[model samples]
Target: MVEIKTPMLPSNKPLIVGKIDVRVGDHVEQGQVICQIETAKGNHQIKATEAGTIAEILVEEGREVVANDVLMVIDEQGKIQPEQQSESNKEILTTVPTDTVQHHLEKDLLIIGAGPGGYVAAIYASKRGMDVAIAERKKLGGTCLNIGCIPTKSMVQSAHLFELLNEMDLFGIEGDFHASINMEKVLQRKDEVVDTLVSGIEYLLNKNKVTVLQGTAHFLSDTEVQVGSTIIKAKNIIIATGSVAASLRVEGCDLPGVIDSTAALDLHEVPDSLVVIGGGVIGLEFAFIYNTFGSKVHVVEFQKSLLPMLDADAGKFIEGICKEKHIQTSTSSKVISIKQTVEGEYIVTYEKDGTTSYTIADKVLMSTGRRANTNGLGLEHTSIKTNKRTGEILVDEYEQTNVPHIYAIGDVSSKVKLAHLASQQGCVAVDHMLVGKHPISDTNVPSVVYTNPEIATVGYTEQALKEQGIPYKVSRFDFSANGRALTMNQTEGFVKLLASEDGTLLGAVICGPDASSLIAGVTVAMTNGVTVEQLTQTIFAHPTTSEAIREAALALIGRGIHQ
Candidate 1:
């Protein structure tokens, strides 16, 4: 499929979609004028870049459009459409899709869940000449694409853009500008982004000729599975069933005002006040997101500090930033109960240091954490081994469960539920089958929290090094000292790097602008076993956030330059 995006006109500002010259199902040749965009400079005609049938027209007349906004999705010639399925009963969605091309049940590979792990594996295995069929009881893209990673990041970008518009004076833009989040439009844009990506995945899967099935699936035996009335027997199987948002079990937690992460996304109206019950990644990300949306936000954490998965230094700095933003917080406090007043307001009662106090809000969020979602798979039907405590499928380095032919990768297999990591595991599993031995070490997986002044970490944290009694040298470089950060007006956090006495890189943490992107360079270096001396030898572009990486590396070698 060809995506026609709004072009970058002479003026870099957003443009208004004046008129659309094309319609869905209309086929046009290359270079045909498709629409007109009214911009600050003048009206510019949008032309079709490729010859295809217009599958979708995303915008209408007078709609304010921006560069890179998907103007249309062109269904290119010869593109195979994946069979679609929709489940009306959410109660029985535990099984995967069952549709098949060949009616017969035998297959080369059968994967459950159309998430990052399952879909990526299906495409790759098909490319390697394997007959692959993936069954998804829900949407084509699983929770990460539909709810967790992609959706949250989409809202984060909108919130950040809102913040930037409000602080335009810092950029010397002289105008009476008032920027407020229009939640309805904000949600529409978010849905557009998700739809674009989901459509792309569907196209890729169909192009690869993988069989698409939709319905509930379960293990009929070790080598056989049941999808609806059909029983499928495959040479190998992979379970990529992902996790779901966990809710707290305190009293009144089921009240109408109390919500989970999924509920937090679709809150059409910004609550006058909000109380987030957990301080982990999900909790803090939403806390900051809604805070920027003009809510009186309060975060209550059972942990002594926020983001307990991260190192203490990063967590402490984040707490300070929250305080600066007027975000109320209470640590080492456990919620006793939540009660809704007759007036529709909620009172959150918690106890801290042997004292109980109450706070009131319009909405209560239960962001405690997530657990492995291994429900309804009928694991008992097979002899596959699973973790008794966490219920996660036990797998080896190759992502192969105790049942050799049955592999499990992603949230269903481990507690570290990252979408990219799940994709990596899928690749490793397929490679192992194709070559006899393929193992990908996940030691360098980076964790990113989409909070303002985003936090990213890879390898070991200083706290972990100390707990294990490992000797390591540490270095720090504040973004306040970075020229580029100063220019962007985002100089709030710092980069911290740790290394062994021998100058080998151990771990690093980034807490500032572009941390999500910056962590990739560190992860690449660590993955290839690059040392501090080797990294400092490489030149980084000047006046960029990435230079802070080299500065931290230099400090690690006791040869600091910018400091």
Candidate 2:
């Protein structure tokens, strides 16, 4: 029997839809498109080089598949053979164009996307003595420094400062509490922050002797990347193109006033009233920011609770805080349509519990989610694989994608969407590339939400424990019981710990002042299997917020002193 394998296109990226274009029992001639692939670079059509009938479709559409794995077997007569390719040959057949793509023997590594992961990867690779070149289509520092995390955090900080000042009256301070926001200045500050950080990345790259190619990069072959007209050949390539705002499917989603998270950050004028669709971290954070700026903000979430993926108690705390701020939150609601009104406003129609309603807003921000930025780089040229629903790169613990020489990390891999996680994953990918070791474990990944109260979590939750039928006990300590919280007048959160039956710390959640910051200690403890007993015996700084964590651990064994 003869096997038909998809040939790598001149663009060396992977086939997105592993053999999706071809089917069992379908006869294909040489050079016929057998599958479609996508990468951070772009999409491409992979053609079949063997003239034969597909005997079997080995992988599903939108699934990542490696090169040389016979997509299907054909009989000696070029008919269907009905057998799949063996696993041993999959690695050998991984259609990396090593031969066709000229290799710059000296350049060991090439990276795409200069986001948190890309820059970190380049730095680490250069440290390991690899000749590294990074190609970026847009500004350095990618979306986080430019449009997503950093800029948004700056805006959030501004809102936080404004909110704190407004609350000064509660502390017996009396003055003109009224403040006017100058969006131009705010935006200029954001620009300055982005520019400084981006320049820092540029400086880092140059300081490390890494080459920076400014252009949209596309895979010209498995071993070669083309940035504009120049082709960069490296033995290893890391894709960290990151992600973009997931498109909302509601009507008029493309309207001018209906903006995604990126556009929302670029605002030079704060709208009088804004409607945010999606109550996830981004939505709630923005809602609080805009509300602090004196904009009437309303949040609509399709889920039953805002930040449902987080600890339910944490979401409840934020919901209560948001309510106190007069920020309306509607859960179990979905946006049906959006239309621009004649009065230069947006008419947003949504449904809650099957009841339809309409709200008018000066601006509409959609914070639904983000998809992997895997369009345009041409993945169809090589045999790499991904999940169709997410377009996220499929990788092993070592961050090895279907193609061994090519690796994917960060948002593109969907391991974790946080910038910190992406940075860690970049290190893991580099470590594996350099020493054949995987440095990250999914359970050890920590995630932080930068909201008013700030949510940070690492490891499992009580709900996850219950779902998994793991025996566990819970303990809680409120910040109100902590001296430092009272002194700061910000005691609206608690630290809760879930432990194993024997009292080993399993996971924890904190929702209050610096919740995101406080989560780190607990996360490290959980990752290293620190027990509640050990945590209780440890000395804690007096009159500090960290004492709450210690108290929470002590509470688990019914020996909490402060709580």
Candidate 3:
């Protein structure tokens, strides 16, 4: 007989047996998963080193085990001789239990988070007359309302107002007056906004009669979960744990002056100078915010362009805008290290063009993307599948996992991490479960980046079409020629529309004032399959920002009324 022992894990702690995939008397192949263990990081699979037949199981599910602990006995020759079978082996085989029933509270649906995805699903399911219970370890509105979207946008509005005030002379208002910013009040107002929204969500949940359980949820079985001491069993379960900010692995990343997006939102005061790593949406938004507030800001991006996912022309236009605002940007750069000096300043070392350079600042914000929060949810307890590389849960059009009744939504399963998308996905999942069928295409989702001049896009991008080899035509209209934009003195960007050879509207890209709100119309048009000719025929108010959209559509058919 050969012994199958647990190997050393990444975290050197006693791991609990999460699942067993094999049973006694079953033949196993080499490197086949026999079981899995739960650790501090996540689940780790235990595989057989050689082909063998399972003779005995030494550990049961939910038992704590350490390194080199014998998990099972496998007979290499596919059979255990009577002389080789000892009393201990027979006792082990006899003592192992196949299953156990734990006491649990019954419900119609159990949602495993209180974020946008979870709460939305609970409320929708409850409205359909299902007994729904939601478990959350933190606030009701999750990261978006509390820290991510609403808070940052509030700060952005403050910075925008400040910018407008600085240009009062251009608006024919001459004054010998000055204004100053008090970060304390700014933070207070942000907190107030968050609190009001959170209270509103709480009221909605109460009105819908959805039970709110305050605790962390762990799956004890496919249909059962334990939230603190209470066990919840439901016919359907939705996992929507959201995501956490990813961290850089370089040295000194954990220093006092270094911070993440969450820490950046709660700063007591803006630093004299700031170094932002990663030139993505979060990084650039904060860079513009701090720069508008009179801080020397520098953005470091590893890619060749800022907003690499956007159209190349749009990204270059924004880069020029950043330069005009005196915000420093370094593209095609890699950060090597960050160190603190004796004077309490941070030195960021990076490589560009095969040359090393350094920049000093009072604080460093690590705005590197985010990772799905799928770890530690006990996913191995069920047949639900996840991406091995990104740890994102795998789901179908209806957000249903491999297991029919189990579902995943939001950052945990979606490729797009926006909160609004999560809320929409939640509604779709509820419709699929209670109603007959409701399909929502992810391609119809819109994306927005709220900067000085916001950027928004919906439908297929130029790069995406080129990659897919789809024949397309493009039309462009500069906002500089739009009467409303020129009148407001905000004519620094343009609008571009993409359509198929047959004149079908494929997508729209807007890079100028109110792009966030303007994209809503484009999204609605695309969702309803509105053609370019139809859009051009629709009347738009004269001298308005939306006229730019109509102009672009008209230009597609060579009938543009404006430049």
For every candidate in turn, the CA RMSD to the true structure comes to: 8.9, 18.5, 17.9
Model 2, residue 366: displacement in angstroms? 0.9
For residues 159-252, write the lDDT of model 3, one tens digit per residue. Answer: 9998898778999999976877789988988887786577557657877889988778889889889887678999888998999998888888
Clashing pairs in 1: 95-216, 95-217, 96-215, 96-216, 96-217, 97-136, 97-213, 97-214, 97-215, 98-214
- How do the residues 471-535 of candidate 2 rate in per-residue lDDT, one tens digit apiece? 99988889889889888888888898888888777788887777777888887787787788888
- Of 2 and 3, the candidate ahead on TM-score is 3
Per-model TM-score on C-alpha atoms:
0.83, 0.80, 0.81
Better of 1 and 2 by TM-score: 1
lDDT of 1: 0.87
What lDDT tens digits, residue by residue, belong to model 1 across residues 1-563? Answer: 89999754545667899878988987676767898888665666677878778999999998997768899988777232223213532334434334543245789999998999999999999999999999888877899888888888889998998888867777788797667778898787777777656755765787788887777788879998887666788999999988877778999999999999888888889999999999999999999999999999999999899988888988998899899988999999999999999999999999999999999999999998888888899999999999999888999999999988999999999778899999999988998878868787777899998998999999998999999999999999999999999999999999999999998888999999999999999999999999999999989998899999999999988898887
Checking candidate 3 for backbone clashes, the offending pairs are none
* Candidate 1 stretches greater than 4 Å from native: 1-103
Q: Rank the candidates by TM-score, best first.
A: 1, 3, 2
Better of 1 and 2 by lDDT: 1
Best by TM-score: 1
lDDT minimum window of 10 residues, candidate 3? 94-103
